[model samples]
Target: LLTPGLRGSKAPAGQNENLQGLKEKLCLMGDANSKNYRPACSLCPVNWKWFGGDTCFYFSEKEATWQESEDDCFSHNASLLMLKRKSKLISISQISQKRSYWIGLSYGVDGWSWIDDTKLSTKRMDWIDLSSKQNCAYLFYRKSRVYSENCYEKYPWICEKAAVQLI
Candidate 1:
């Protein structure tokens, strides 16, 4: 049967020496205890802003209209933050205190929906005023609830994107 170092015939003398050198180099690199060895996910990209739960979140300090915020997120290859899980609210609240940040929800012809066109359910939202005339939704940190605001009004925003997988 064919095997390494015995492919059809024995490797030439010089070829064997080259293979041995390569093997030693690979062994050194593969050592787990080596100081140079680091996990693939040890460092996230500087632009990711914040990383959690396989997702990256960015909180903007500058204020912008809801549409402008959406555009900004798109430019970064992300979208306006859409909290699908209730648990994420706590994380968001801790990051933003006494400030309102634009999310993805907005009232349109089909009622409230995320910028990605996903419909929002009343059961999943904590709205402060359901009857507000505003069309865009923002989170109020103090109450840890959502409130409708004029879409034209400028406000800080949050963006979200899927975390990069480490190879």
Candidate 2:
């Protein structure tokens, strides 16, 4: 029942440990000199989760093909989740215990890359298998890995968009 207050790191007794860890992990993220301190609470949409750096993430409850999922995200003016680091990917997966969610990665004929056409880093993919048939990526929470699947298959997805700011 506890929520993040405007300031301070207070939380209920049993929840403090998890909250503290989340705060610590989040501390390692985002720009230190950014103007907006906590944009998620005030700027992000109601259903989206604030993911530091003015990024709001929306986790879908329903399943859809990768293309369909991307279209859905576009409908909301967002894009498929496109994280690069393994630890960052796992952190987001931990929050979404629901199931695997389609991300913004795929293996095109040229090579593996994110939706924005950025190449997937070899160092980051070192531990991943990248099976031939499975081209699209998803956050596999049970294993804390970014596993791939056939893009035609259906799976729940995550959408990412910047928190709206009025300047």
Candidate 3:
């Protein structure tokens, strides 16, 4: 078995390709100059995959209602996504694929709503889909717009927790 610090210190042949692909994708994503750099998920309790950013996101295949998903995320000290601008939304879309995930912002009794203490304002809000508002929000690949999906239908999710911004 080849140990991590091998004699030659070279990665397996195919592994380099995967790394390159990920790099290319990230390069295409461009810089993080927008105001939508929100936390996708945080890994303080159980260790999950590291998503490069300070935050961590999860893709749950297990089906559950929207409220149930929110409860699950809150239990872990994270909340759904609440994008601040179009650029941020696009950045998130790139990270997430076809699998849908719940975000913090949604349409409630008042029309457009967000989790308590969301920093976004109505003027800076951008809805993936203005027409679709079933009950909860779901993000999908190639979706120029967002969809309102049932909470019970499980999909991938992105969580967010505040980080101390460096001055």
Candidate 4:
């Protein structure tokens, strides 16, 4: 009701002075808990990592075939990681930590393509076999390169999807 005594802070006016003052003092002394800091809002799940600014990626710990991995991603409303930018490839490569991951690339009758059927010209890869034995592509044996491998081989995969804005 517009009381002058309570007009300054949103707090109850009495408790805030002591608590806020103490909290500020504690925060100044490196007490992280005193600030009640929270992590940034994340659209990705706890097990997923947000990458490329707009996508959420899930790096599987369990190995699966290309088809099985794709199926798993589909079940999660996502797809295998589809990358085109060399810079993005490098970013993921650093995070790969020397472990390989199946990407969304594969060879088909129409040449190499991403899972979404986008044609990928190979300025970023080599030894891309057109053989039916090794049609699926995986990432990070060498930094920033994609290598084709047997589609039936079991390997960890990455699933990616667009992060939705939570408003």
Of the two candidates 2 and 4, the one with more favorable lDDT, higher being better, is 2
1-167 in candidate 3: lDDT tens per residue?
12122434555777766645544443334346768643222223353334455555555556566777788778877787766667657777776756667767566666666676453364734556645547677666577346777556666566666431211
Estimate candidate 1's alpha-carbon lDDT, on a 0 to 1 scale: 0.73
Question: For model 4, what is the alpha-carbon lDDT of residue 31?
Answer: 36
Instruction: List, residue by residue over 39-120, the lDDT tens digit for candidate 1.
Output: 3221134655554445788888899999999999999888998866668878888878468999998999999887889888
Candidate 4 global TM-score: 0.67
- Per-model TM-score versus the true fold: 0.70, 0.70, 0.56, 0.67
lDDT: which candidate is best? Answer: 2
Ranking by lDDT: 2, 1, 4, 3
**Model 2 off-target regions past 4 Å?**
1-42, 124-127
- Pairs clashing within candidate 4: none
Task: Itemize residue pairs with steric clashes in candidate 2.
Answer: none
Candidate 2 lands at a TM-score of 0.70
lDDT of 2: 0.76
- What would you estimate as the lDDT of candidate 3? 0.58
Better of 1 and 4 by lDDT: 1
